[model samples]
Target: MNREFIKKLCEETHACVRILEGPIGTNDRIVLISAKEEPDLEISPAMDAFLRVFKHVNDISYGTGGSTDQIAAYFTACSVWLLVASQQAINLIGKQGSSIKSIQESTDATIRVISGA
Candidate 1:
């Protein structure tokens, strides 16, 4: 765990994309460790409780993304919620995805700013 990030609040409004996107600039991939297809009894009292408790995930490996940068990449695994949360995954796809062309357009613009284009 990163001691620096432990105290900081989560500020991600964009839905998380769990598939490994190779790597985020300088860090290794983030993985999902716990939360299985069916969680053990100790993890939850009911299915709904299990769903609610682990709705969001913490990164299991060190991810490389600038906390203060306008646009940065994050490399992490699918939270187990991703497997069960279709609506949530759809929401992320809607926000971060579209046609690849649209994503390319946005990334192109962002790259210009980074490269002083």
Candidate 2:
């Protein structure tokens, strides 16, 4: 994995991530800034995928106990993961007209694989 890339993401978003802790569940469970760190800033699907990844609203979570910037940074980091996740989906699509659900599942599988889930 690209440690620097993840670190850069956290730096820009002002958050930190501990890979060993890993995602709570789902092959593509995204905490956005990720649950990797306690987000302290506002996070959206553009900047994260908590809601996007989790179909259940009550299941998607955002941090509530840290600096706003920290939360933003954390989301930013998760955004980075989302970025990577998107890339994976794109790759899975390749030249084939793949189904959206299939692409999502493929990318989600990749996220957990890369995140040490």
Model 1: per-residue Cα lDDT at residue 38: 38
Candidates' TM-scores? 0.21, 0.23
**Which lDDT values do the candidates have, in the order given?**
0.32, 0.43
Clashing pairs in 1: none
- Residue 16's lDDT in candidate 1: 21
- Candidate 2 lDDT tens digits, 3-59: 675565556545443344445675553343443443454663233433322222333
**Residue range 16-100, candidate 1, lDDT tens digits:** 2232433458555442223223344433223322232233233322332323131123332222322324545454345546543
How far in Å is the alpha carbon of 21 misplaced in model 2?
6.4
Q: Quote the lDDT for 54 in model 2.
A: 25
lDDT of 1: 0.32
